[model samples]
Target: MVYTAPGSAAFSRKRGSMADKITAELALIDTELAAVELGDIELNSGEILVGNAGNVATAVTPSGDVTVSNAGVTTIGAKKVGKAMLVSESEAVAGNIFVSTGADSAIDEVAVSGDATLAASGALTIADSVLDGSNVANTSPDNVIGAIPVLYRIAVEDASANNDITSTHKFLVTDFWFVGGATPGVAEDTVQLLNGTNAISEAVAKTTDANCLVRATQLNQSTGMIAAGGTIRITSVKNTNVAGTAYVMGIRVA
Candidate 1:
């Protein structure tokens, strides 16, 4: 072509055509933008439009595991767990729970009318028991004879004439046993067992070997040997006659 000035008829006509093309393109862009702004875009279910950091929304179709984050208060009617599972803060009331075998393991409420039997493969530990034969099996809640509670064990070398043995706590003496030094088979030592001022078992012969004397005859019977906070004073007839260490073991029931 040929060069022409800006005010020329040919130049003005070409410039007008270019301006028309630009105006038409801009109008088409405006129409498309209006459609988008009106939310005219359609999507299938589960498809979503995500916004970027620039706040521009782009259509995205997620596959595999779609993470739902920052959603508050999700509720489910029922959930099934397969294989091993862990959960926190589970609670069970006084109701029956059944495994696949249909056996019911029920927890009853606190006892008001009758006794409740607790049976389990594990131990049933009772912190406090008001248990009795009516509630517990093979339970002698009142019997203390079967229980051996050692109140005090006194050891002395050649106990003096008025050797006194004191106990911190009072106990009901079931039986008193003493091991003293003596010639085997030679009964030479004699000891008196006294409860405070009274002699419970007097002239009790102790040999070189072990001597177990049951003071059932001397016991108060209504109460055991001695009341709580009571003491027993053991006296030796001849201190030099008793050769070895005199160990006095007192057995009692709590």
Candidate 2:
């Protein structure tokens, strides 16, 4: 209420009677705002004092939290804050949650289906390396190429007799072999090669002397043998005086 400025000064009312009627209505509105213009002066609220400033450019309504302490650079445009929690107990650097372009980066490239469990206490680092199963290729039917563990080669031949050696005969040697004719003892034939079928390896014999060859070697493994299963028998013998023919081959190894 005491603002004088026009035609010089002197509106200083030191005492009070409501400070001399607000110093004569502020010296008649400072002689009409001193002929206006000072950027046309506008004060729409309670406090406005520019010159020796105490900066307070606030326009707060329903919007609250806006704190800038040791300010160096704090620029906020459409500042709207309701719940924005940023807490740090000890180490808080830069504080970044800046993700620029659209829809949260396509929802972070989603593709999560089955099992992904990592209950770690510490060390877990997977960079880049590949070596799946090393080398694995297996075909069915009588497969016995050195048994099984990390197999190398297996192709037990059957040509067309198609008995197919009951598929690669993996270790089941039941000890029984005899196929003799032509004077080695007139006639002797008994072949059961292996029994106790679980993964198969059974054999018997019948020949019309297409070259007569049937022999069984030490073929061993008892007390429940299975490192992949085990058995081996390969024989060949031919002597024709009238009847002679036999062929048997069984080999298993793991």
Candidate 3:
């Protein structure tokens, strides 16, 4: 290989070959780029092209509970943000949550105290059993009322036999009623709830003996407490011909 002048035949030939190779490479690149453009570059919801640390463009998708709007605003679904994503001053304690102590202060791990408490499993509980108007908070639902609903359990026994408050669990007998059943006798008789020999509720008289009607009585005495594994009974004095079911309503306290 001998040195040649700039306009020499060999120099021109070498330049032309170099130009041809560069043009061919550029044309191949253009064809590959066109294929990529025409192919399905479909991305899932909240997916976008992002340049990673390696300076390579990658298709990235948000978590299941996250959404990204076309306007570039990202939204996180409720209960989606975990403690790992939060800023905390130290290791989070069991049942403790991150909170802003004050403006311009580091986020702190604070335990929910007073009326409310959080469990290590992320369950929350309130010390108070009942909620009233005063405890209600102003919320987005407007006039948000917090209430603990009392669920009453029902015990039913046919009039043929007394519904022995035979429940294994302690039940605070609140209300008792009789429903007319098959073959209600001609004459109406008295029905009442009892704890041992003492009557817990006032005796209720049947509306009629035609197997048609009955009465309800609310136990107004503390004697309505049915001890667990204890004998609390319902006694009905209906005639043998009379048939009905007695329903005792109460809440399980234990």
lDDT by residue for model 3 over 1-254, one digit each (tens)? 22223445544555457778567556666776666752367765557889999999898876578778755788989998676687453666789877888979978778998888999899999887655322432222122353222222233343544656454555566567766555445444556778777788876665544555555545756677666576666676755444455666554444
Q: Model 2 residue 114 lDDT?
A: 29
- The TM-score obtained by model 2 is 0.19
TM-score against native, each model: 0.35, 0.19, 0.35
In candidate 1, how many Å is residue 249 off?
A: 5.7
- At residue 153, give the lDDT of candidate 2: 18
Off by over 4 Å in 1: 1-145, 182-188, 208-224, 243-254
lDDT per residue, candidate 2, 1-254, as tens digits? 44545342343433456667677767788877776774566544333344434465543222124333233334344545322333342432232222334765531222222233122233333334432222233323245444323212112222212212232323323333334344331122223333333322323343445434554444444522322423322222222232222333323333
- Each candidate's lDDT (Cα)? 0.47, 0.35, 0.61
| Candidate 2 segments exceeding 4 Å error | 1-9, 12-103, 106-116, 120-254
Q: Per-residue error at 175 for model 1, in Å?
A: 1.0
Best by lDDT: 3
- The deviation in Å at residue 140 for candidate 1 is 11
